[model samples]
Target: MRDTAKAFGEGPAASIYAGFADLVSIGTCIAEWHAAVVAATSDADRFLRAAKEKASIWLKEYAGREHLLALGEIAANVSSVSTSDDGKAVLSKLAKQPLPLGIFASHPKERPIFDGDHRSVGKEKPKLAVAFVEFTIDGRPVADIQHMAPNVTHDLELHIRISRWPEKAERLVLTPLSVESATLYQLPTFKVSAPSGDPPFTFSVRERAVFSVPQSFFSRPLEFKYGAEFQPLSVEQPVEVVGQRTLRLESVDWQRNPQTGYANIDQRILRIRDELRRWPTVSQDERAICLKLLVNLAKHVGQAVQDNVFPGVWSEGQFQIEVRKALRNDPSIGSALQEHPRSAGGIGDLMFQGVPIELKVETNRTLALEDCKKFIKQTTSYAVGNGKRIGILCVLDTSPKVNPPFPMEEGIGILFREADGYVLPVVTILIQGNLTPPSHFSR
Candidate 1:
């Protein structure tokens, strides 16, 4: 059962991921990182080891330096119990169990050190190259690094398959333990006899990058409305058999942005904003979200909300949150958008659909055309400075006097677009009526 209210952003961690914008840069990195790791490797042995080591270091910031010691502890934990007469039991338990996934602040689960569950087929008899690590996000593989070489062939191939979720915050998170390889017994604990290679590395959550599921992904008590699909993040990704083949990574040469502050702003935030500038290039899912947002705000002179979401209090911040939440769903809305002016809120409310959207809460009921025209003086600069063609001005009218022709639903009229470019279309959505059953804005 899912808590229907979860559709509304509510909870302790709700603000952590204000919307999809919070995950843009990280998600892109994870997707591209897996591809690079596989393309850089020559054999399954290298791929498996590299996946753990690279993803760990890549996510060093989030997982922290403490994870390094955690890996060693995990090696000891698994090896102590690994010397069984039949390794199948060890493999069986490893197969059944996976790394930690769900996170419940109220009732947290026990987290272990390393989460590398593996199998051992004699090296002499190599299995067809399988996934050294079938790269996954939330139990679904989003990309392919190198594959297990058939007969230790060392062949490689890469494939990326990204999934789309209905919610904005459902963006992907790359785990440290996501790997599939041709070589069985890839876990650090399985290496009984030392091999001649780079230093023998052990796999552990501590040694690697392990992202706790975002609070948004936390499953609700009923698993709806108030929560996300909370699944357990396992130590090892589920392994599967596949044909060995050579593959190439996406041609994208991904790298962290250089530290060039755009007037004292963080480089990470700038790069994400750069990506957002390219939002028109993304898919059309935003139209659905925009429509939903508009209908909700207009329902009963209030809001119709997303799919099943009901009308709640409509404030300027609430409008900003909903717009951020809605626009974040567009694949192109790839910026960890934040409030303007670091601490002090500025004229601009926030970024949505990759553009800065200003929320104008009409304190008075009567909103005439002249009032909207005056607002352009305040918002046109954001569009001009950001080089955006669309200027979003969301006006929430708690009173219903000068409504109608003033723009209800989405009013796209001529605004200003600084220099040469498309007409700066200011999308004005009017949400009228106070507590009364005022009709939707018309003509």
Candidate 2:
């Protein structure tokens, strides 16, 4: 019973072995096909050699005929040369004379010895005659020759000087010399006068000439910045002034007086008291400075206003002083007034990020200064609160030599650490000579 059970399990294993044998038979058939493809590829090299030999034989048989056909096609497309009237005239002149002979002798002794004897030796002895012709054409020396005759056979001796030869063969042709052909040759040297100068320059005998000029003749001194001028008000208003002043700071005009070597500044200022009466709130310091500026301007332009030369109304000092007293009593106004400039600084233009900045002004000096200081203080406080830094980039247009009193005329100074524990970084840049973007900051 144990043997019968073992045989029953082996029966399934035998069927699986039969299935694998069928798969192996199919793989053997694919291998045979791949071997046949390799054998065909191996024969291709021999076949290509036979094809190349056949093509070479065909080309050799037809090469001459193919070349002649190609030449015919090219000739059909090209234009033929026609003789012009000048060319015909030249040919007519040549037809009248006998063909010229060309001879070259290395030794002076070998040169023809012509003692007025036209006859030398008869037949069997070569007869020779020395025909000396110093030829020139268009004033240029062509050839100096002593021709030996009897050997001269053609219409023209194609003898050409290597240096003076035509660049193109079509321009001049050289043919064998013969009788009835005229020979014209150019001389080697032509006289040319030198340009008018200290030493009269002269040229040697040659095919071409060259001349030169002195370097001093082409150079001159260059003058720049002649009679250039600018206005003071157009000069950069201090950053402080730009932020504070109430002066309706108008545009600046630069005018020059050629006779006086001076520039006049026309600072346009408009005084409107009605606008002043409408201010709801203003600091006492601003009112005081405004009053002082008006009082000073009045005294300066008093005669001009009276004479009708200047057009503007002057303010009352008493009314200005009273307004200042009222502003001083207010706590908020007093705090804001404390930040104004302690001393008057020269006016300068405003610039930011290397560009000019425009601002509206009230034409009030004290108010302008106060606004400028307030801006500085606010920027300072903001920097302090955020732990960040503030930088001031000052740009000036004038030369430091003329505007020596201006603060920026001096080289830039940076203010970094503040005494009140508020730190701000200020960079003052002076733009003097050329209006080039500041190199101090990198893009």
Candidate 3:
């Protein structure tokens, strides 16, 4: 027999790194990676170099890699030097914006909130105010609009005011929240005076300082383009009359783990748990339903493993059948539709309240992370086809050499995916199969 201690660190470490890289690209571990990188050092230059290198590598692999690479390039070339106190204040303000360095100057303009057909007349426009019905922290709701962390519960009361109320406004459906950062130049061109000397000279300087501002105040509310639903108010007040809402917003930054000096999964989860509430659209009940499904699935997974239910080779169909059976047996989930045909092309493995559920059984000796991502995308397509805007992907891991089993809490996650111009939240559940009994392994 070989020394177990010596064997611990051996085998496919590179593959594991690649797997995590894939996860980060898909926004599965973005908050963790971002927090890690930001907290790694206080020197901005070091941060830029490391971020640039990583972004450069990721851009080649992930087609939908966000603006990090381009932003890195812009930030690297430009040196932020403040000659005056005003300039220092500008730099301080820029640091708070989502994209501190600003997106590329040549990047295409952002899509307008209202199209030509939906434009408001003159100064008349719809006003929206969000009041938190239930928040994790007192008053202020965490706003991780990207959904990079764990569960986000939004219990909100949305107050909408407009010049004209909808004729058929029994039900109000609000959109998901999207983020936009705006960069403005203080001055286009200015005359610059040379340094004091016997013969002082002046010249023209066309470049001006750019200041980025997060659209959180008035221009940009946490409102998405589509999907999240809201109910209209039942008050007897007139359409034009609306109550005022005041919220004191505060941001939580840099919660690092004691040992790692980086934010862990739980910390990231806690920091953003109440984020959805700020959007004013996501209902607490809807989130509770999804959470219930996930929690129950997790419990069933643990119990099934304990019972040694999955031990041999199983096909995707076989796995789906068994999973559906398990869910059906549970009194909570009475039944679920199987192999449900969608309006767009292929069929989904399961359907619950129109939400697509795609099941996969991995038979390979080594599970590739790319394959995992493909499994998610498959479910996302189904959800988009069915017009659910949400999906559940259950990947049953049955590899023989499965080491370092996925964590119960960390194993389950919700990641955002863009489909047909809308951001869809996809919940991923990893179900491990063919596990050795706990008594069989030495501590």
Ranking by TM-score: 3, 1, 2
Scored against the true structure, residue 185 in model 2 reaches a CA lDDT of 22
Q: lDDT winner among the candidates?
A: 3
Candidate 1's C-alpha runs over 4 A off are 1-314, 329-337, 341-347, 352-354, 368-370, 400-412, 417-424, 433-435, 438-443
lDDT values, one for every candidate: 0.34, 0.26, 0.44
Estimate candidate 1's alpha-carbon lDDT, on a 0 to 1 scale: 0.34
lDDT for 382 in candidate 1 is 72
Alpha-carbon shift of residue 88 in model 1 (angstroms): 77
Per-candidate clashes, comma-separated? 43, 39, 1
**For model 1, how does the per-residue alpha-carbon lDDT over 401-436 read when each residue is reduced to its tens digit?**
433332232332234434454445454444443432
Superposed on all Cα atoms, the candidates' RMSDs to the truth, in angstroms, are 25.6, 41.1, 26.4
Q: Which model is ahead, 2 or 3, in terms of lDDT?
A: 3
Between candidates 1 and 3, the one scoring higher on TM-score is 3
Residue 188 error for model 1, in Å?
69
Runs in model 3 lying further than 4 Å from the true structure? 1-289, 304-307, 335-339, 365-371, 402-404, 419-421, 437-443
